[model samples]
Target: MAVRAEQRVDYLALDGEKSWVDFEVKVLWLVGVRGRFGSVHGMIKVDHFRSAATVEAQIDANVVSMRSKSHEEWVKSPEFFDAEHYPQILFVSDPIPLKRLQNGGEIEGTLTLRGISKPVRLNLIKPDCPGESADNCPVEAEGSIRRSDFGMSSRRGTLSDKVELSFSIATKPMNGSSAIP
Candidate 1:
């Protein structure tokens, strides 16, 4: 009898080019406010053979912006994000199955906010591939987290505990090539 060997494939590294991370939270227990971070950077690795993927990202907490300047300032204050103290929000995910992601699955990961690291599960929508290749692919995902879990407990009655997050990430091959096939 002959023994067969299993094949292993290397993951393709993709760099995030243009990405946006936004959050929506209810204020005053009724009104919804949306804000977005101005600076973001990340990298993603995809294993085509295994249909697995991993993502790591950093968001600049100080660059948060909203329609209202006062609201933006308030969010940056110690009462909320405390951007001066916590300069960055980080996220790293475990290996996620691409098949499940294609069918609207969730990615389990750890999100560090306000200097507190906690587990978070982000629900992913089917990735929208603009072209046939993997290069220049943009992905969108949404999830929510409790502010109290991250030590953001100020104004409990006025601000909702749950904060909804959404992301739009555009990726390109790390090798400085066109879309990855």
Candidate 2:
């Protein structure tokens, strides 16, 4: 029987070109505040994670947190994310399907945020390691979308409708490694 290895969310993008994909996933968001940026981080529980890979991870209000430059503005505004009421965002994928890319391969996935789920897919164009390194095979994939769909209308007039979200994550074999990224 052929061993069909499952893939995970490796990395994501910010701005347009600048991105990070070295064992970490980050969500960079822009708000109405100047010099203020917000981020969310989480690790994929690969074992608890289902393969064939249709999975849905709820970013718990307790587990996932966000930060802003000013505590007053951050705390007072429902216009911004109400971490108290709606504390979790959801990312649900339907058994990620891979399509062979011209360079390597690509994956199509779905992500849900603010109680809204949409089809999201990324191009996993690079293999984990060159010449087949299953042990330390590195995988890089990415995809994006507009935030308005989820009703994030704070900066609707100012923020770009084309909120591009992308990621680059490298997965290692289940060798009792730590999930601290």
lDDT of 2 by residue, 1-181 (tens): 5323432323221211121321111233354222212233333333212423233334433232224436434533465445566666555554443323214554655666555677766655555455765334434455556656666666555555555443433333333433322
**Candidate 1 runs further than 4 Å off:** 1-17, 129-132, 176-181
Q: Which candidate is the best by lDDT?
A: 1
Question: lDDT per residue, candidate 1, 1-181, as tens digits?
Answer: 4322222233334333378899999988689899998677877766565578788888888887899999889989888889999988999989888786567678889999889999999988886665556555557789999999998888888889999999877665555322333
Candidate 1 lDDT at 87 equals 82
- The global C-alpha lDDT for each of the candidates, from Candidate 1 onward, is 0.78, 0.42
In the predicted model 1, the residue pairs found to clash are 135-179, 135-180
At residue 178, give the lDDT of candidate 2. 30
Error of 1 at 41 (Å): 0.6
Model 2 Cα shift for residue 81 (angstroms): 4.1
Model 2 off-target regions past 4 Å?
Answer: 1-68, 71-77, 97-106, 131-138, 170-181
